[model samples]
Target: VQLMLVNLASPVGPPFALKTVTPSAFIQNMLQSTEERLNNTTEVNPPRILEWFDMSNTLHQKFSLIHMERPLFQPFPSELVFQNFTPLQTYKLPLILLNNDKVLRHVKLEQQESEDFFVVGPVNSGSKVAPGMSITFTVGFTPKENKDYEGRLICVTERERFEIPVRAIGPRAILDFRDEIFFPICLVKAFTQKTHLLRNIGNSQAKFKLHTQRPFSVKPSFGTLDVGESLQVTVSFHPLTVGDHREDLLLHYHTGEDVFISLCGSCEELDIHLEPECVTLKRTYIGLTNVHTVSLTNSSDTTLQYCWTMWPIQEVEEKNSVLLQEEKEEESKGQRLFECESSSTAAHHYSVQSGALQENGTTINCFYIFVVQKGEIWPNTTAQFSIVFKPEEAKIYQHTVYCDVTGRESNLPLTITGEGLGPELELSYSLMDMNNVFIGDKDQYDVQMSNVGFIEALFRFSVPDTTFGRCFSISPVEGVVPPGASQNVKVTFQSSNLGTFSEDLLLNVNGQPHPHTLTFRGCVIGPTFHFNVFELNFGDVAFGFPATLTCTLFNTSFVPMNFSLRVLGDGSGSQSVSSSSQVSNLSHKNWKGHAARVRPVEFTIIPAAGSVRAMSDVNIKVTLCSNTVKVYRLALVVDVEGGQTLQNLCDPALSSEAVSREGVSFLHSQASIDADSLRITLHLPDKEPHQSNS
Candidate 1:
């Protein structure tokens, strides 16, 4: 028999060379193959080693080359590398063996004893492979530790034994997650969700299964993650009752690794409290807005949304109409619904309107009650807002307001009550007439101020800016009057100067649109008085003798008059008397008579100073005593406190007289008497005692 050997070391050497081999050796190889096939236990027994010689005659060794065929059985993958896998997790891969020769052959696959790697299908017993055909076998790898694993898969045939390298990597399974997750306070029957990253930070694949108890759940409970891969995991907390909730999310991996994530959450019921259930506003004036503030507090852990429900306009109007009808009916029956006397007190007649929501989203027309603010109230916080009440007319307004909140079973009701007052004050007379007023004297008139409105009236008199206003004064300039009651006000007029006075007085009342104007008209005049005679004469008086005369003073006015009499040239006399008599003496110069003698004259007037009664008169007696008997002139003047003065006029012609032993020289007269003043004349005694100049 001949054998062929190929040289692999020498490039230029012969590719194949025939070699001489003993027939016994060839026959021995055939017999050994037959025995191996008959026993079918080559997997248990190791293959026999054969020695051969190469083309260079160098000694070498090869395994199982029985038939000497060129390309016996070949495996397509000369080496097998398993995918990276987790510990204790089975991973499988396919290995294909092909028959490359033109003959049929029996093939078997075997692997070295390794606890982590193994091969399947006809390991001990062989299978037949046709020429140019292939056979596939599944190789599984199971790693026991976290490390790289290598093994050999041997493909045994009748002609040769081929070795295919197999390798596998043991991977670590690591899942990255937060150790604890806390959820915020939530309302009962509501759910809250939290998202976290589930990442595989290891060098191999990771498979996990998540589990949790009640009130806690996770999305993507079980999943597979590749190396360095991550996914979002959502954890939800849904509570059925109000309380604190605690749970653990268990993440179980196929590699026997477990992780626990703590979940904490709480739930609470909705509660919102109102500070004041009823609101009572003070008495408000008509056409004025009064505000009252109220508070809404949130007592729960969650924020609450709240809004005030306004009373429906139609409903309010209907209620007001009904109340009006009732009032009318009561009036018809002679029974007053709201007593005017009670209006100033605590009793009130109000129409209560129920709170309701508008279905059509119409604008709220709250004519009486208005809400200033509405919105959300935070947890453990209080919200205060204004409730304004403005009345258009005098009446009582009562309303119920509802506050609708998120968590309350029913709407909160707030009662608001207010009274609108309009003061109706009137004067008894529009004009106060004092037809004639005496100067420097006070005149008073009584006036009535009545309050006819349902509410109490507050009134004040505005001080007038005119000069005449000072002459008039009204008592009780400011006062409060009850409903249906009247107040008496005394108006007095006092003036110093005489003139016609007229003034408009303003009465200002609360809640009145305009001030009440009252007019006062009057005329002021002085007292009237007159003298009966223009002159008092003591003529032809005897030397060292006395002469007497009489004069009358009259008062025609309603007031009394005061009078005084004095003789000119007297040491004590009035200023007007002295002034007038001095001028008269000068004018009556009569140089022809005054050079005769320088004698003093004296005059005495009875009742010199006295008051004359109204519409009456008083008589005055004037007596003159002269030593030289020269003509003397004087004036009598009267002065009243608040009336014009009255005086007698003197004639300068008769004012000067000459006294001598012989008959006095005749005195020429020039001055004339006037009607403004009372004049006195003194002369020598005349026969019959001047016949009493009465």
Candidate 2:
């Protein structure tokens, strides 16, 4: 006997099973086929839910199905958070997945592609979790940047899927600092501090440290800052030397990275105060002293030894060099100046004329300055001192007095300035031109010297060491002229020579830096004269016969002239040896001779020494005798003693000819004369002539 379970329907059933079934031939056939298919499979058949009972051709069956919840594969923690994760570095934490149902389950973890958080374990494809047991996995977080990261991981099982939130806490350090820092001027061995703000503008806490060298320090060198928080950092500088200082500050981070910052500052010398730091005196006369008082106060705790001295030569020369360069640039726009040799007499004369040196005094470098007090000054005390300005020149004076003190880095400079005043003298006639002046005669000129300054002027007159300069004589060479007054100075010019003369007479006034130059120019002339005959021609005469000729001399000047006539060169064709020389020389008689066998010639003049009256003529007779028949050449030299016979002065055309005629080779004299010698040639040719010498 066989009983078959068919589809049945029941709205309500026992507590163990609640199902609906229906009895049908088709449904029974389908169930039978499904049971056959299930029995043929290798899988274990499901537990028999129905039991059939047999009783003599009758069957009783009971069906029961228990329905229970499916198992869940979930991570132990619902959410995951990774803290203190460094960027580009891997950080790991443990995670667990538990199976809640009483069954063996296979689970897998799936997460979105991310760089910050990831999962690591055997949960990539599948992981087996027994009933009432859990499987472990590794949750890894690697942050690339400094920020918070959020993610989700899916725990997938055959029957269920679970979501787990994942997060990573990334911490970073950021510093906002300037690349360079500068500090104000500070005294040596003093402390100066500067404050700056250090903030962490990141997602988490930051750790940092500040490093520096000697003479520099930082407060709170290493510390931590919270997110969006700021901290004040103070940098202190203490310098031991006086000068500029530079250093670098390093900022180290916990991530093994370093940053550099530059620090710079300057340290000056000790602080010493001087009351009335400058001295300025009123306008005073030269050769007088003006005094000014000042005080020096020490502000430091130590006593300082101080001494007043002139500015060091090195510093002075440096300043002077700059001034000289500026002066040269300014002077380049004007006339050029020439340097003179000090050893030259002209330079010495100029120095004397200008009174470059003080009278009856030796040269001194500190002549214009004098310090009354020097030594040491106690701490927090003031010492009074005096500065005497003795001006030796009548001009502006400027000097820098330096005080050298102990415990000071450099000397203190104090400027002293003053001006020296003197009399101002003006000349009425600066230039004088005496048109014509006769030799051995004096000419007078009067000039008014006025003193326009506030003081008296004591002036002395001098001349240069020149021929024309010596010709001028000033009456009352040295005298005093009061202020707003004028003095008449007599200038007399007397010359013994004849030429154009120009000179600058020096007027040296006391307290004046430079002398006043007065210029005078004139032409010195002499008496004028002329002769009727320039050459005397004598015809051929018999041996031992005498020939005489007459010529007239005219003196057209305003003065008389004393004259003497003589003959040179006897016209003998003979060569003789000079007593001072061994070589033979052609005799004077044969000088420039064109004919041969010229016999000795003699010349005689009547009234050889005489005077010609002014604006009058005088008759002169010349007699010649030849001993041989030959050409004779002689010069009749007429020397005048009182005045010059200026023929060229009256006639401009005769200048060259007169100079050439006066320069004769045969005429020579040792005594200086005012007038040039007149030369008349005596030519006795061999040919006969129509006229004979008178």
Candidate 3:
């Protein structure tokens, strides 16, 4: 029996068919007819779907229809798959189809939600695909809200239809910034701030966090950015040191994205230096002021404000015990001050004077503060100020001045020094006497000078142009005396003229308000008589033995002089007349009987008087005899006859009767007597007592 099976490609019936035929011929005929039918059906069928490709150049097997032998089951209803698409957003993808057909064909794409996606090129709704070529079309997807979307794209050919799965995700949050880096210049210890713009370009809100390094801070560090909105974040830079500084400002998003902003700046220090570094005032007198100037310069790159204050000067206590006690008390209390005592009242030892600018453009005296106003000194500029030192006592003083800015920790130190002087001079004696000085004689008087104050005293001597000036000479005309020391000035009086004179010695002391004066008085006399020895001593004359002694008389006068001599004893009741006495009696015969006679025996004058030339000397011989063991005194009287001229030249007020009785007397009488006595002691021979004792 012969059987026949027919393969039906129709959608309404089974794929296989059966038929009855004759054994060989009929089978051949049936085969021929069936091959012709199959050929016609293959020629009329559309191209089959091969593989799917997306815009990322990746091949997807989810919608591939190449495995026809395997069971045909759809894991997902939609053939197009989007792995990581966000919701509420539009995603663009290129849809490609691998075609293995031998002829060209036309294709059509259809979707339920057509507004959500768009296709580019001429292959949008209907397109033509070449044989053995890929059918590529650009598809765009846009989502309205945050949700997942699923759809199918139906690609239809002439005989068959294919479905592509369409998946879309909603809009996502995105963070952005306007600038990536920032640069700012800031001063040290000053605050500088800048603002940065943060933006959110996405459809959803975004949360961001800001971070920075030390000395760098950010405001609004954490915040939420709305959709299509921008926020300004403030970044502040507070530098602690000078020079270049750098930091990083990072913005962290909730989506694990970070935005970096480079923070850069420089910190400069404002420096103020003083020229000469120190101020020194010259030595000033007590109760006077000395001024000194100091220059201040700004050496930095910006304007600076500076204020100065002087430290109080330390107290310089005197070495006196009373002052030392006061210093101890002050030290115990941890206090320092300059104290000066004047007339039992306490006073400050030193004071400082500074100048200050007022509102009215006038300068006023400021005791302690020195400051320059804001913006007064520019960079590389200089300013000068004066400081006055006034002291109440003499001492070396020093102090330090500190200059500081308004709100900075930097400062400058300047030193100030000065010396104070107090001058005082005193005279030991206000008056000096040269005593009685003869003509052509020199005499000196000492005047002591002392410096009692705290400074050196310079003194000079001056005398008026008078008789005393010509007669007196001062040793130290000008000299200096230190404090607590004394100097002796010799004032000598030497003159050829005879008279009593008075003068004033003037002492000009340095810085003294008045000159010191000393009165000097002296008397100058003419030539007169002088005795070499005022008394003759016959020391140990034995009893009944005679002793002779010689004495000299000088004629200090300028003219020749004749002198007569007489002898007087201690009334021993004995008399002896010399030969020269009779000759003196004959020359003065009118007054011979008026000569008084007294007991003179123990002593006798050999040549009673003689003539002496001017500036010459004469020797007188005297004889003494002591009969008993007793001390004997005898007076030798010499009368000066030619000294009347010199007597008239001397001051009568300086002459007295007592002065006339001794030697060196200028007498006004025709004959003036100068009685000089002599003493003789007879010891009765101690040899006699020694012989008896043996």
Candidate 4:
């Protein structure tokens, strides 16, 4: 049968004319074609073209068949098809098939295996393609070697089979680098260098070009690298400013590929400083040494060398008065120096050194040099040394110590200062007491002010303007005393009142802020009486025996006095003295009362009642008689009849003691007098054995 082919589908321009062909010849052509087929059997319809209708129009036919020209069936000709495909060796390319038929058709697309290449998709796979549908096959082009690779994609259908040839080229001359970024630090005005490796991981040789910015230099800017070979590119950074700097280092290959590397750096200024920045020596006494320590630190990246020197500070003394014109000129000049003695001589008064005693009691002297040589100090480290000051004068002196480091413009200054003490005022006594002085009496004493120091001492005395000022006075209140010499100042006191008086004498030394206080005290007296004896001690008396003694009384008053004597006894004694009136009324009363216990002691005065002239003396004899083997004490009170009472007559001169010479039990007696009467103390020995038995 004869068939007529026509294209009713949308055409680019004019419609194609109809052409007639035999069905047998058409089937033969379709079966022999290389296009993909749906099945292996040759029972298939002739090639035809159909006008696709909008399925939404229900009246239109869903399927139809018609014949078309050669150009209508094949949009891409053999020459136009991509017979060879080259891709990067690192990646693969997918193979695809498109169906331009107006009716549905079954197709199987797959790859053909070869020794040089392998297909990833299944050649026996099948799928149905609708009109205008494109399906991707599992077939892909993968380059196995650097050489050209050949492969084929087979499309199988029921009527015919088709083959697509493919060729791939592996990439050559690929460029790579070990690092994509480089960072370094550079000092100001200095440079840092680094190296980067450029590698060719590809199969062929690679050509590269290196590039960077200004202040960043690279060596071997352009070079070639073989497969599996690497090249080192050195980069140097020289920063002019003190901050961060950045640049791009690029490697451009001849194959139009680029590798980028970042160059980063920072610049900083170097610094070194001393910990304290200044050293101050401790205060020292004249002829004594004081030491202080200072630390030197290096904070920079490099090592340092240091040196030091010391010198006394010079001061100018102004002696002459300046005129108005000269003063104006000096003010204009900022500062003026006057003609005076040079302080350079003061340098001899002090010395600086360093040393300390070890644990073994041995002294290790690390003496400081006046001018030190270069001493090396590493970065981030500290060094310490001592400065000793020994002052020889009594004046405040200062010196300047300069520490110098290599490459430093100026030296570090340390101040050494100390003061010396001159002659000091030393008092023989800081406190004094002018013992009791009678009322309205005048007394004089002296205090020695000595200069214990090496220089002369000048002092000024100040006394309080209170009662002390009126009652006490000093001679030579202000004066100068030579070194090692003493000056005595007389302190005179005139007692104006009767109570106790005390004062503090203030002595101020020249150039001293505080004054020394010396204390003085005394008491004043009024009209009083004196006694030759205040206490009487009776020696040991034999038991049942009597002992006797005499006490003399003196009248220190200006008038005659009448006196009465009485004897009193302590309660512990067997014998007690009777009351004066009672004893006068009944003389034998005391003896009668104690007759059963023991006989009471007896007392008598030469004149029971007597008178004494002014400034005269009286004698009284006391007799003692005891029958018991015990001690007895009697209070002997000699009272002035109708006269002023006398107190505190227990004078040390009148106190006397007597010892028992016969080995008999001894009795002790002591007498003390107050304002009204005399108090006597008696001690009785242990009762005698013979008396107890009797």
Candidate 5:
């Protein structure tokens, strides 16, 4: 404000004539002004500075009580003091103020009750003309009585009566607030005991997650911190690095927020008084399972006894049996606790590898064993645990298996529904349908699955075997059927060839495992094939001799045929019969078959040239007997002029031309032929005896 005023008064910022105020003088004046501003500044209202004090000790007759003024209410700084003898009694120390030598008001004092301490009152001490005073708080302790004396004066102030903090009462509070003030006492220290990296990790976790990075392997909190009562708590910390050692630690916790007690040093036997004397359950572990063991662990400097209680271990003695291994373990009257005390609270838990650990009547010792019922347990006799995830391991599934995991206690029926792979798939055809079908008829297949489980479930589907052609695929890759929905999955199939083909569809789903499967069966047939046979074996079809063979045909094609009867060989037989020399249409019989006896030709006939005949292609259709075929051909020999013949002919039905009475042996009557003209200019049965001359 003064700087602003100077600028306002001078316009050009500030005048060279106006000098800056002296820091000391300005401060003194400001103090006076602030004092007047406050309704009553406690700093000026008869400041009670500690001017004198005396202790009953001879080492320093100047039994002086030193009191300085500072911030009184807080999370104030705390302090502690150890004496050779336990103070038989405690006294109140006060610093008072006077008006005209008569008591006008008293400054405030700090006690262990508020939880922590601070400096207040006489805040602006020595500023006012007040007679200073100090009460010697005669802590009733002398050299003769031999014992230990302890006094913790957390914070200070004259008798101005105001709020303060709690401290000096114990080590826990110090560690809990170590980041700020140093408490006046030997506080909780920590370190690593065992060795190993994993265990050390436990400490690190317990540090940040449990206590503020302070190592209190054995976390101890007061039970009842009254005028004079002592309690000890032990803790165990597993060190994880393979090494031998010790590292000083500071454990921290608030006596206010999280827990109601403070932790003190275990260097000596200290008295503790925690409020709310007894609690419902001092300690408890509530999670997936029950308590395993309760062992006393003392990581402090002293040896002590502790007791513990286990969780809900009532009734079932068999389930609650505590097995003691390395040390002695026992169960006491349905109640459990810990008894032994040492420097570490980390108990050797045999129960971890054994069973349910029940606590024996105290916080000292404990025993444990595996309980009848285990956690994370399942009763799936069919559930498979191995997986062959790599492709190299895929084709050979010998390493893989089918499995179903059912809750042993749950007993839920499971069915698998799947696609890509079907189960029981490896299992043969579901049930077969025999009524058969028409070429283009629709058929339904009934695939059966018996749910071993009481409840119904979906069974995955797929085809692991049988075989599938491009003609098939399953629908609703996965289908959902409730328990016992032993329903059918109708598969529609079509046939291309005139025969029967079998195939399987796989189903999966009910957690039969990744590759779990089921079976779907189907058989498709070619138009319900009906005929003499699939094909006819005529031995070797020929010409004109009119070889006769009788066979029956079947009505299979589902169509009626008006097949006319004619004979041809690989043409040899027919060609030898005749080739008329006429451009005009030739007359022939509209012959048909009906069990009539057709007479054999007795005349020599021949084609002028370049003409073909075949009993083979002409013999193509089949009917009657079985949905099959049977053709007949006869060899007819004839003498004719030899000129050019068919080239590279391989048809079994076509016999070579012959001369005279000889059968043919020529692949080609060659001077060559069949520049693909069906007519051969000339051919003879075995080169005529006299050659062309004849």
Candidate 6:
């Protein structure tokens, strides 16, 4: 008898408050939603099951013992309780929900009425929790169509677990724990914690954390949207006492899961609001205009109380049509813009300041004063400045502005107006080259002056009257040319140090008056001198070969000379001669003492046509213009080629010691030429047939 009807009522707080008629919050929310559907129940083993691992350690696997489930027979509760059955409250037999052992499934039994609590401590703690009581043995079960089912059912009370003041409630809190109560599980955890046709489901945020631990307050609605936005949604549910007026309750908006719908009275009220975001302006004065907006969204999760009214209907169509921009190549001096206007009744203000819209519009935005000058026309870069509103020219009026573009902005309707004015008086000028007028080298050239225009043009700078005092020299000698950036005038020149160092072009960029003339160009700098002709001569020839000499190139330069020529020889048969007349790009040739300009020489003695000249023997040569020192010399005496001598000459052997066959005057050494000293004579005839030496 529910422990003697909770030991005759009389309980209160912290005993886990339950009394309210044994439904104890409906059996503590059905044992915590049946222990969250048995923790996502996952042992599903019916249509087939054998499992048994262990072949690990790469198969011959020794440490064996792998039953991995294969023997689970009903019973599986491990515990469940909702205490506080009255009697001054203090009942708690949930000893952590019958501590284990379950596989149960359809094992029905019935018989209530019987509690007789006699003695124990928690019969509301006033003591006496019945030392013995528990007659209704088994109670119920709803399992028949079992395919895998499982167990656990300990209904204790027989002898009520030891004497006086014990056995607090049925199952006597699991009668002293532990006893062979099978533990196999894996038949999808034996039908989700002991049989119930199993379709287990847990973790819905852990079952909404036990009703968010009972102290409520959450206001969430629905979301997502972005089509020309304009929304307001709110949804909140509360049945224990309403706060944000539960929007007519009846919500199953699962949208699918067996579908559901029924909301239109502006969604049952509660600050609904929806509709009011018309934005589609797509313009094109030459690109960019499609995504106009007015914005005000807040799709919901409970939170919306906006404020802003006025505008249920205000019209004025006609949005886009453009294709203009191209006409600013100079030649249009009719500019005007700078205005301000006003009216009486509640609104009106027209203003103008444009002029640079020409694909052929020719000076617009009338009623002028000085809109925009200096090469003029630039106005509309998407109309960076526009405030047009016209009316008092006779009647009607209305004008508005708060349009900054994407959509969803509320109140808008005040078309256009016209009347009060004020703002104009502009000017511009441009004349550059603060660095383009150059001509220097003692008599100088500096004409760098700038001021690219924007009002302030009045300049002066010249040197023409037959080029002033000859050549150039302009300073402030011709004033006033200002209006837009640029200034610098100094054109000096007087270096008559003549001949080959030139540069008289200082007319590069004179003051500008036609085609922005600030374009000066000229570069002249001279003086590098270091010329040649230290000495070289080619005169004295014919010895059957060898000879060449050249170097009369005096470069009193003004710069300009590049050369190359080298020829040295001592290898008999003589041969070595180079010419551009023997080297002379005239390293600077300014020859004043010789009237410069010497590029024409001749040196021909190229008569060494080979035949090995009897194995060669007769040399003297030198020719250098580049490999330095000595520009030319050749005395390659490779003679004996004309009319032959001694049949081609061959007599030159001197090995003393084999020179006497009988002589008288000692001291004979002959055969020389350029080693000087000659006078030879000897005659012998008398081989006993006439011998005579004289």
Q: How would you order the candidates by TM-score, starting with the best?
A: 2, 1, 3, 4, 5, 6
Off by over 4 Å in 6: 1-71, 76-78, 87-453, 456-488, 492-694
**Per-residue lDDT of candidate 2, residues 1-694 (tens digit):** 0111011111212324522222122123223322242222221111111222232343121211213222254344444556544578776655566555565556677777886677777634464667756677778877777566888776665554546777654454566666777988765544567899987755556787776764566777778888778999888776545889998777776755466788899977776756677778888776666777778887877555565545542454455566557656764674433121212122112212322233222223323333332456688888876666666668887766665554444556677788887778999989999987756556789989999987789999998889878888998899999989999999998775678988999999998899999999988765556668677777665444678888887766554555677777654444221222221344434432522444443566887866665677789998775544567766777665533333233343545543222331211242232223356776666755324321
Give the worst 10-residue stretch by lDDT in candidate 6. Answer: 205-214
lDDT of 1: 0.59
The sequence of per-residue lDDT tens digits that candidate 6 reaches over residues 1-694 is 3433332222212313332212122223333432243342322221112233333433332332222232221111112222212233332222111111122111111122324221122232221122122111221222222111222232221111111111211110000111111212111000101111111121111100001110111122222222223222222111111122112212111111111111111112222222232322222111111122233333433322221111111211111011111111121332321111111100100001121122221212221112221111122112112222221111222323222111122222222233322111111222222222111123455655554433333444443343212444567544443444456666664322221222222222222223223322233322111112222343333211334442222212222211112222322222222323223432213222222223212223222222222223222223322211222333222121111121122222322232222222111121112211111111112122113110
lDDT of 4 by residue, 1-694 (tens): 0110122222333334332322233223233312222112222122222232243344233433433332112222121111122334333333433455676656654556665444454353465667665444433334443454556655564334555555443344655553335546555434567776656666567777766664566777778888888888777775535688887676666755455566778776556555665555554444556666778777777655555534221211111123435745774595642221112221111111211112211211222322233355687787775666555544666655555553243445566555655457889998887766643345688899888876677788878887646778889989999888999999887643446777888998765556789888766543223345555556565554545666676655444444566666523444534334333554455544544554444444456565565567777666554445565555555544421121112122343432112322111111112433243333345465352222
Best candidate according to lDDT? 2
Sorting all predicted structures by lDDT, with the top scorer first, yields: 2, 1, 3, 4, 5, 6
Q: What is the lDDT for 389 in model 3? A: 77
Quote the positional error of residue 641 for candidate 6 in Å.
Answer: 55
Using all chains and alpha carbons, the TM-scores for the candidates as numbered come to: 0.34, 0.35, 0.27, 0.25, 0.24, 0.21
- 1-694 per-residue lDDT for model 1 (tens digits): 0100111111221224432222232223223321232232111112222222232332122333334433355443444555444578777765555565566667777678888788777453465777666677878877776676788877666645656777653455566677789999876534678898877766668887777765676777778999778899888776545789998887776865456777999977665557788988888776667778788887766656555565433444466677657866886695742222111110111112333343322222223333432346788888876667776556777777666554553456788888777788878899877787655556788879998876778888865776668877889888999989999988877665567888888998876657899899888766555667666656565643555778777766654444455555653322112223434564434422432444333556788766566678898887765534245555554534333221111122442432111321111111112335444444444334233211
lDDT of each: 0.59, 0.61, 0.54, 0.51, 0.26, 0.23
Best by TM-score: 2
Q: Model 5 Cα displacement at 308 (Å)?
A: 19
For model 2, the superposed segments whose C-alpha errors exceed 4 Å read 1-269, 273-283, 293-295, 299-305, 311-372, 376-384, 454-458, 479-487, 528-694
The global Cα lDDT (0 to 1) of model 5 is: 0.26
* Global CA lDDT computed for model 4: 0.51
Task: Give the per-residue Cα lDDT of candidate 1 at 646.
Answer: 17
Q: Candidate 3 — worst ten consecutive residues by lDDT sum?
A: 343-352
Residue 302, candidate 4: Cα error in Å is 18
Q: In candidate 3, what are the lDDT values of residues 134-203, reduced to their tens digit?
A: 5555567676655556666666544345566665533445555533345466555455667767667665
Residue 57 in candidate 5, Cα distance off native in Å: 67
